[model samples]
Target: MGPPILSAVDLDKSYHSGSAELVVLRECSFALANNERVAIVGQSGVGKSTLLHLLAGLDRADSGEIRFGDRDVHAMGEIDLARFRNRHIGMVFQFYHLLPEFSARENVMMPLLIAGEATGAPARADELLAEVGLEERGHHFPSELSGGERQRVAIARALARGPEVVLADEPTGNLDHENGLRVMEVFERVHARHQTAMVLVTHNQELVSGFDRVLRMGPGGQLEQTDQEAPR
Candidate 1:
């Protein structure tokens, strides 16, 4: 009924490699609605992460449009784009991009700090760390934590901003099966508490059972639902 939380139309992106233009996304188009959970499954190099970047306004598409509600994401200037991203978008990458110098709590507090809330950030950060099951590890730096712990910290950092839609690029990629399930549980907790929409790019079909939809990226850089499996 309402406008989708995010959408892309006739999107295209490519990489230039010294006289060779490698096309990655070809007329890619899709949307994720409010409180919806979507899983993207495909083999390596299907431009899944690329599409996520485009959707997040981290990178611009070569042509076509990406919209966040009524805002044209592809048309915003740098400062406006940065503000918009900080206010409304959260991203978790396969490699946890936690700052090495900061503790887990500090890393999770950065977004709030940037938004100019100095007083209560630590408490908010505590809430996020606890939600992700990392409350005990908040004092540890990224190098001091395990791979799974680092990823959980990253997830906490992503949720710190209370973004409307979270874009996760292989959020569980490097974890063991048990760790992967644990990370997924943190996602579930986030959804239950915040009702954030999520677009997750993952290879684990087993994880798809927890999402509202599963769409696979084809060789042509187009997206298609694998089957009409009922939503979870």
Candidate 2:
């Protein structure tokens, strides 16, 4: 409905391990429109996660610029980048990186607290948990929840910061078919309700089909457009 919410230009990332340079992503470029759902699919080592990291400002690229509206994420320093990411991007991972010590409510509240809005943290956390279908389980810790439930909590946590873009890395990698589908349902709900642009890195074809567009990664830093409609 508007100009691109996120754009990656000539992105490249490489790591020097010992004497060899391992180039993970090369010249990868793409644009994600506002409220768009996009999937990144590829081989294990093709750098899907690396690309997500760069886009989410979790890491830096050797060359390239990630634009979120008017801000160039690559140019932000550590403090500004952290603040910018907290306010503008939400991130989810396959492992359900919830703290074992905190209840689901507290876990989701962590991001809000970090952003210095502790007063309404619990109320907002509860609202997000309910949205993700984890209202009754808000008192449970990570170890007490199932894989799907944990991911639901993670989804709630990610949305807690009220970000414009949500980046998920291998979100369903550790779940069974039923749980994975349930987790995906929650993702869809989040996207629809928040109108947040989503960039999901998933190897599961079924999951990839849920997005508006699919981008495939190839060796030597190639990104090719695949399906452009939501799979039915």
Candidate 3:
């Protein structure tokens, strides 16, 4: 309806291996409306993760413009970019990156602490942990949690700063079918509760049931809308 909450235009990215150049994205473009849920599906090496990284401002595009609402992400200085990312964007990787020594609640409180908002971080972290069905496990360390539980903790941490958008890369890649389903259920509950916009890069199509749209990334780094029942 209105301008997209997040958008990129004419993006291009490449890497150099030895004397050769490997192009990952070529003139790729994308958009996400406020509170929209989008799933990106593709074969491995199609630059799905690259696109996600670009969208999250984790990496800069060689040539492109990334805008989160009215802010130009790529144009910001390092300090401003880091602060912007900490406050506005959340990220979840395939591997749960929780600090080993910290309890689940402490891990979730990380973003708040980094942003200098530790005054009520503990209470906020507990609320997020509870939202993800880990209320009782707040005191447990990452090593003490199951694979599914760790991923849920990561999700809780991502939501700690009340980010407007969450960019997730293979959030359930390490889980079994049952665990994956549980994680998806948690995502659904979190979405309903917080209305956070999500852009998920996943190979598992079955986990994309309730997403607002499904995008298939081609080998050339172009994204095309795909049918819900599209062939795998």
Q: What is the C-alpha lDDT of each candidate?
A: 0.90, 0.88, 0.91
lDDT by residue (86-108, candidate 1, tens digit) is: 88999999998999999999999
lDDT tens digits, residue span 1-232, model 2? 4799999999989999899999887888888999988888889988888888899899999998999998798899999999998898899998988999999999999999999999999999999999998889999989999988999999899999889899999999999999999888888888778898999988887765668888888895587877655754
lDDT of 2 at 55: 91
lDDT of 3 by residue, 111-222 (tens): 9999999999999999999999999999999999999999999999999999989999999999899999999899888888888899998889889978988999997689
Poorest 10 consecutive residues by lDDT, candidate 3? 223-232
**TM-score attained by model 1:** 0.97
Q: Relative to the unseen true structure, what is the C-alpha lDDT of residue 217 in candidate 3, on a scale of 0 to 100?
A: 94
Off by over 4 Å in 3: 229-232
Error of 3 at 147 (Å): 0.8
TM-score of every candidate relative to the true structure: 0.97, 0.96, 0.97
User: What's the CA error at residue 53 for candidate 2, in Å?
Assistant: 0.5
